[model samples]
Target: MTFPRVQPEPVYRNPEAVARAVGGKARGNRVTVHAPGHKKGSPEISILVDPSAPRGLLVNCFSGEDPVAMKDWVLAKCGEPEFTPGDRSERPEPRAHLKLVRRAEPPKPFNDQYLVARGYHRSATYDYTSTDGEVLFEVLRYEHPTDTKTFVQRQPDGHEGWLNGRGDAVPYRLHELAANTADPVFVVEGEKDADRLASLGYLATTVPNGSWPEDLSVLSGRTVYVLADNDATGDKKAVVAIDRLSGIATAYRIDLPGLPPKGDVSDWLDAGHSQDELEELCLSAVPIAANDNAPPGKPLSIFEWTVDRFVGEAPAVEYLVDGVIPLGIPGMVSAAGDTGKSFALLELHRRVAFGSGIYAPPIFGGRVVSEGVSVMITSEDDANEVHRRIAALDEKGDRFSSAGKRMIVVPLPSAGGARAFWKEDRRLGLIETDDFKRICDQLHSIEGLRLVTFDPLASFAHVALNEDPTAGQFVCSSLARLATETGATILTAHHMRKSKAPIETLADAREAIRGSTALVDGLRLAYAMWPADEARAKRTCKSLGIHYQPNRIVLGGVVKANGAARRIMSTYARNESGLLIDKTSGLGTSAPAQDDLRTALVIAIEAAANAGAPFTKTGASGLFEMRERLPEELRRIAKGRLDALAAEALERGEIVRSAAKGEKTAKWLDVPGGLFAIGLGNFTTGAPR
Candidate 1:
């Protein structure tokens, strides 16, 4: 039987040995080593040893060293040049390692004697358990012979004894925390502090090594208190915890009074602080409000400029739909009312959700590049309307079965009344709503999210988006942040300005989109759809041999691509099911193509009558004489086809012989409803003369 391939464990070197080889100093399991070829006073690079890391080491260069080079140098110093830099930014889901196979050998029974025999004394033990009370791992604290403190972890190997390496890291006493749903949870820095608080009959927990898990839904909708250490690192960790917990939980920062440098809750308790004092501090601490981050008191000084500051090759631009929609940025699609822009955006979202490989067929006539999960939030369409629209896209239900698995459709009216993501407050000016925060939290929790669409921008932006440029910019920037954080394309549908004239150019298309100029400027990509004007509609229908029905023919193109590619357009005819299908194929044909030839003859006959250069029916001065008057697209049609189409039009009464206005004897070949020739001399002779 075949089994899933397990990722091999990374080879790790002793932190002290690496520090010695690199002429650096070791602080616990981390080393601060200067960059190779470093000048005096240059900042040092930090190398951390982490067993759970894919590379077994994490490297950071605060000195602006190239990360790839710094990692290679550190690995070379540690005699493991094969190792590469690890991506430590992404925090995996908690308890993800539960499915992995355990070590073959069983863990030895752990006791104080085991450490005592090795000249070390056991100080404390913290059990990392699962929700079901299973002991996944244990973190053991030890006092070393060198008068220093250290911590090591061992995993339960299923049989009995512990394995050398640790299992999945989870919040301490997670089972207990999950059980007590009412009490406010105190989040401290270390396991010992959590234990201390737990001993006092209060619920508490801490994460392993200050690395916050990517998914923390258990603490969602609950009050959380972050008790940080009394040092710079602790302050940073507090900020991180607050940021990660944003939209997930209501968290507050607690700074204990009269604690020494680097001291923690354990030290505060050791100082004879009672539970009442901690509770008082917790109650008085202010909640971390949204957008509460304050700027630094002083501006940062200028740095030394260098020509070669950039270390690697420039990154290529990524796209969700090549040229039409860029990836990792916010963009917009807009059209007038009843123009089907929302339907177009929804269709795009569906196509992106079905996308999975390196390339896919262009769904909206643009290549699909990135594919994964897609989300669409509709403010105007409720559950039933959305269902009808989606159902119209596919009657067989085959595509929906596979695509629905990766697509999340939220109909706002049914879920709740539509809530604006950005709104103006009399006191606070412009601010993002709590709903926005919650939505962002949910988006972050979703793995493999590729696209997020907000149908009808005005629905989410409220009225301020139209009146205030600041609100427009703020809403767009906030959405951009969501896109960046989740690594997905954030697209929104907007309404175009109501106009009688058709949008004929890119500039016009830009102006046609409703809202302030800031809204258009803030987006990286913008596409627009519009109904064909009377003249263009008539032209298109005449060419394609179809009747012109208002709004049945639509034209759309990329109005703004932000330099990704040249502008492109596609002609679509709305089918009976209200779906837009590309009809550009009808325009492709030979020079003597029936559509072009007929259209040219009609145009030429009209132009001649208007210009007082009327053509006769059967002479050199006939319709072929007016070939140069045809539209540029049909000017290349062969002379013979032009004459044949003119003859056909005459025989079919598309064009008729009419008496000249001033000269009754002269006749001109004029379209049945076209403008008549004005003067006797401008008229054409009758029939086959």
Candidate 2:
């Protein structure tokens, strides 16, 4: 209760203070709030009691323009959400005082990309973040207010978070429990049912997962039977809603066709249904919705060039795809060091420009095609340096491909007189509209320019990526436009940011990029590379084995690599040798490609291990057990030809074991001995902090 003093004194009044004081506001009439001892200096709120209610109705006239507000709103009372409007000062009869404050700013952007799109299917979960200056904290709580009363918090283990909301939070597992619940299990959207389902002797819970949870430990105890909402309908929404959770459990949607239209299971229970009716509904689970968007046909190769047509290897489909050549999305490569950066670009330039067949092969020392490819070197490297690299490529041209793949490299002039707000400043801003068009004409003049490569993204952008927003937008837009307009495949490289750990993430290209997010956000296909384990990487060229030189893989490299030592054991087939020769001098003691399994494995075991950390008798014995236990295909004779190659790797000192310090055992990764998992330790110095 707030009583305005007959003679009021201005002490302190702001939005927050007013909100605390105002219990209610009534317009037009000055209802004399009768409070005792109304002094000018000290004011009190008079909470009108509802005698029976433990707390009284907080009384205060919140400020507002009765004329400005709607009639209904002018009469409404306002109060805080979590209010325990403390006791009224006993000195005199008090009146609750109230006032208003201006509105706050709009909410921040959504954190997850998944949430940004419109469909949530089963449920839409929100992620909350609490930051205290330099430190950032994240929390995922799916306490659906709709039915939280029935849901109770439980003690949790392992995950980083305050399970009961009582302790300071660590990392939270808000989605669902990853327990061993036998085969199939039933899952719901809210916490209450998930918890209750487990007790009802059914395996279930509010699946906390927004995306498909890959781990199946949760289904250890039961086979899954995903029970979807009884209300959702339609071809697209229903299927996606179910498809998103296809693997967790075999889907079985609850069929509520006989109940009130759109009535949920909770509604049925609320309506006082007998036990039998509820049981019947649960048993009548329907099949999950069907999927209609099947995958597109696989492309023969991820990358393509013009010759792929006559060459017989390219997809050779009659119609060409505009944005991402359907399955032919070529990988884009980048490097931090300038040498690696330019070399990578030059290699691609040589490959597509001349079609000398860089990765394409036998077709050329590289491969020769009918016409040359066009390359737009927008990167800011010195034009002379680029010329020199091309000269080197040609000198080694004999070492690369026999194909006369010529590239017309056009360097965009670094400066311009006055730039077209949206154009590349190749002419130092000197070009008029006609001049820019002529530049395009000259490029078009090149007979059948098929691929373009951009080096050092920094040089291409006229403005600084961060500070100059307008320039960044213009440059990124230009690259995208050129790719579309020219019809020539465009491949450009951007510098990868410095990371404390190795970057194995497939789409990590987009995140570490320095400039506007637009650069990667606009690209069709992307690939990322970085040095792997530093401990082992330093040993790459140590001569521990015969073939331990720093070689490239998928145009990416590990900062450090862990490999076993091996030699060039004999090969069985002839074609494989054709690829191994140094295309430059075209000189090498080439060997057969295919050798049977036993011969290959025998060679590897004898050679790959290092004297630095050679496999002891104990280690060798374990490997023998492992080899014996391998599936039928991994055995000596029945093993496919590929296994024979792996066996040969063991024979030749090709792979060297970069024995990790203090490691008694190491897990096998896609690469020999990369990090065991995403969050595991690396480097001898320390683990992830």
Candidate 3:
């Protein structure tokens, strides 16, 4: 029996084949094409297919069109069925990653008559040579009679003829650059600047138009100094050069001060700067290692685990401060402005460095698990401020008395400007500055390093931190890497978003953090502080029998932690020295102490009435509510206790609740005869019901 002829399935999964079928241009595994139904001139769709990628077929629409619909259109044009857009089996083999190689094309001989015909005079010619000194291309500078200058490039053809366009480009002095491996190389924007520096006996090279060369591996392990012109474009090109040379060499972008708006190194040299002065600037400039942001170019590998691998016990999570901030991880202490966050962080650093046993209470009631060396780099506080704060934190001068070298305070403002650890670029997002690398290197050199702190993250993390999650990730991940590599807990003090609402819950505390949510999510631990609301604050002060001060009381705790942890909020009072003292542990518990607190509350209410800012019976507005006047020590006391105290006072007539004149909704607390409630013989109350 003869079988019917079977038709083969159409293959629309190959990006190049589909692109060609749709009249699109394919370069390597990616292709650009216009949407199948739209006019063909404007290509807005990009399709990429590679078996090695996690997803073999990828499509993008540039004009804000639906990518799925665009992909379907492309597939339909390639003779694919409506239901076949999800198919991926026909993709090409995995593309191999290759290093860039220099490829030069033959050039035609120079045409001197060509420039003369255009009313141009040849001023200078710069030759771009190969590694062996063979001239590959010549860039000719031309000037018109009107003083207008322009440059044109031509390369030599095999027949000694010249071509108009530059052939495969190389560094201006390729042979010398490749041979002189010891001398530091300077890269400028144009050949003229390179030539100017070369005339001064310095090794210098440059690429055309301030662009990079085809290959730069020859400068591996060398020191490269990138010199920028005075223009904004020059600044951008210097950044590009630094980014490209990051892994291959130690690079520094040296700005020659006192140049004209569009002047260059040649102009700076002509201004009478000595070679020794230039060398001094280059030597003093910090070297930036660009490779810090480069990706690990390793191939993906999958590992198989067996049951036997689980036989051994896993390591326990270690902590720098037990049960609070974990060791070898990144954490943040965030608070609203003037909430004493800097003071709190500095105290924690001081306690950990000098051993907290000297202090009355530990940080967040969590004991320091590791006590070695702690380094604090502060951009917000200068040396004098930090010194005063250290003295206040250690009234006994313990910091100087014991383990003198345990703490290192680096106030960036005093040193110079507050050098940012990470700088945001319009194109590159966040890039690590040389200051960060230098600090890391110094930290690594210190023995027994346990902690490093960056005060007020906004000053150091120079980015649009609140709007960008990637910027948040870059900062946290960079700190995490440093922590993991150095076995130290990296802590950063950051400001929380300003909100009038009290942080009653841990979730609310997390929400109060200033930056992107990713900032908190990226941390292994996050502690937050916020002002206690009026009700909560008064209730606390009443129970503690302490005077209430709104700005002096704050509630804080570990809002986020990687593992199961005690997430309870703790109350702190700003002491005379601006240090936050944990007041929850100091609450009075005896019945006599409770009577004294209630009596103090009654007197406080009478004083408020006499002062004209009468205490309200309840509610947030009007004169401050009863709860708003509570002290920090009474924070842990139940709210019902205050309510019961108010009720008993009303019953005994020690304090009478009277509505203000012409206001029926609001009730004001007033003492009878305006006499002190405790001094009067009418006070009588039992334990709160």
Candidate 4:
């Protein structure tokens, strides 16, 4: 049978040919085509063709051709193709080959003239050399008359970058570091410092850039003194360096005083500091150790699962001011307006300063421990007011001889002066400010300081008392810490909330304290003071035979005593001289004595009325007869005292005087069915009109 003439498929020799055949751009350097008899797209029967044709034309070679003829053809046509032995098979395919060439790189740009135009003329160059003394990079410090100083670094490979970016950067003066490994090395922040230190005949080194180096292994086993710049960032970097070098080397951080912020060792030297002075400062630096970075040791386990562990191990409860004020415990004194809280605190301050018994019989029934120093930080009282109060306390004759020196009275400065206790800053909110630190330092310097009083807690606290509970707690906790650390009793005076209702009970009084409940919660002991009730004042007045002033009688009671059985109640009576007297003790004028005289006068008046010999005037025969008829209780009272009592009674209408004008003077008679008349035999049933 005669077959039609078969047409051969065109071969692709390059990307253009492949693009033409496939109608798409060639993607790669090689292409594959399948023969007609082979399964379409079968890799085994495919013709392997190179895009870079060696013969400069497409070759139509069959897969099963002679190997030597293919090689000779390739050699003759393409100058010689790289060949490798292939697997002998019934049907083999031509192998493909490829070669590659690299493109040239562009040159790096230099701007020496630009740097010069900017007034950057190199003043000094510091070589960052390797351990073998080969210069790996150079750090150039440029100076300008008008502009600030600038720095640039150049590498041996013509790579111009910042000093921090040098690829082969070692510590500046690495050779010197290697030679003086045993000597103390001064590690500064910059290359200039390192060079300046070296010029002073000292072994000095620094990192390539102003920043700390990542790999500090170069300083291993060496003694390094890192002189930190006087700024926050410098201090921070120095801390980091010290932390990194903790275990690897013996490192010390030297901080110089009187250096302005951002001032470095170079400035110190320029300020006329000598090498000897620098060495002395270095010697004062504290050494950095591995343990410095370690967290605090775990606290002792407080949870006791068994009684065996706690048997006989419980610590005794100590007191800072005995029973009333626990030692080293936080306490608060709160009072309503004009309640003599300040006078009470001043009295307490007096007792603490002189180590005398507080308020004679003791307000809270606690004895003073000793004559310890007392610190009174008052923000409400001015210097003159404080002085006046102190002078009044001195007049009481209860103050000790050493009270003047032992008592510290700090008056509240007007508006802008330093705060007595706590202060806040933008950087440090509340923990400790410069003023606070100064106060603390001053307090710590005092010997035997046992009592610390902050008058009006609100004035001393940086935070709003009622707005933030946490801040209140912080203030309380800080005071508590101070108390514990210094073994002092801390008492803070606070104000009570304004309310029309009276503080009847201890709980009511406690709730009346202004601000968050945290104030009471943080205290080991707390007391509240309020104006005495009208009935109480009346009773006191009647017994003491003194005119009653609501402000004169103040009642104080313990609101919280952490370990006490019940709240102790007490009274403070301010006399005409503005002296606060503890009424709990019979230290003031005897109320019982006055009560005896009132009773005597009542008996004499009732007896005279019953006998129809009522007193008719101030010095009448009836009044004289009544005095002679006085009872045994009234016998001891002086005639003048009895007359005064009778007059006072008549004025209050406890006794009535006859309005009849027949007598020369008004005749005084006892009120019928009155409190005093009821005790007498003449008891009238009707009320006196």
Q: Who wins the TM-score comparison? A: 3
TM per candidate comes to 0.46, 0.30, 0.57, 0.49
lDDT of 3 by residue, 1-689 (tens): 43333333442366557567877756445677776566633468877764543234466888778766776676577666543433444333222453335464343345656457657898999988888999888888888887457677887776777777775668888899888889999999988888888888889988875557768877877888999889878887887888788777878889898989988998888888889989999998867644543455677555545556666434556777765677788888888888898888887777778876745665764678788899998887888998898878777777677676898888888989688889887676677876788788778778888889998798898887899999899999999989988999899998887777656666778888888988889888899888778776777777767788877778888878776333546678777787888775664452324544554466556656544556665565222234545544333456677777777767876677655444454266767654222122122243110
Candidate 2 local lDDT, 1-689, one digit each (tens): 54553332222223222233442211111122222334322123333322222222324432322322322221233332333224233112234455445474333332332322322222322232122221122223422334321111223223543232222332122233343334345555543444445555555543332223444444433333444445443222234435544443445545444446544445545566654764566566444422212233467874665555564322322111111121212224455442154554555556555544345432111133323465555535456766676666666563245444355555555423222323334433421232333344455556665666655555444455555555555555555555556655555666777766654332343465555665554555443444433333333323122233333211232111112111112111112111222121221222222432333343333332311112221243333434553323334433245344543444553322333445654322111332222212233232111
Each prediction's RMSD to truth: 24.3, 25.8, 18.7, 25.9
* Global lDDT of model 1: 0.72
Ranking by lDDT: 3, 1, 4, 2
Query: Candidate 4, which segments miss by more than 4 Å at Cα?
Result: 1-295, 302-306, 309-316, 337-343, 357-366, 378-406, 409-416, 419-447, 532-551, 575-579, 586-689
Residue 507, model 3: lDDT of 72
RMSD of 3: 18.7
* Candidate 4 per-residue lDDT over residues 178-232, each given as its tens digit: 8776779988888878889999888888776554566666788777898899987
- In terms of lDDT, the best-performing candidate is 3
Error of 3 at 674 (Å): 58
What is the lDDT, from 0 to 100, of the residue 87 in candidate 1?
Answer: 29
By TM-score, the better pick of 2 and 3 is 3
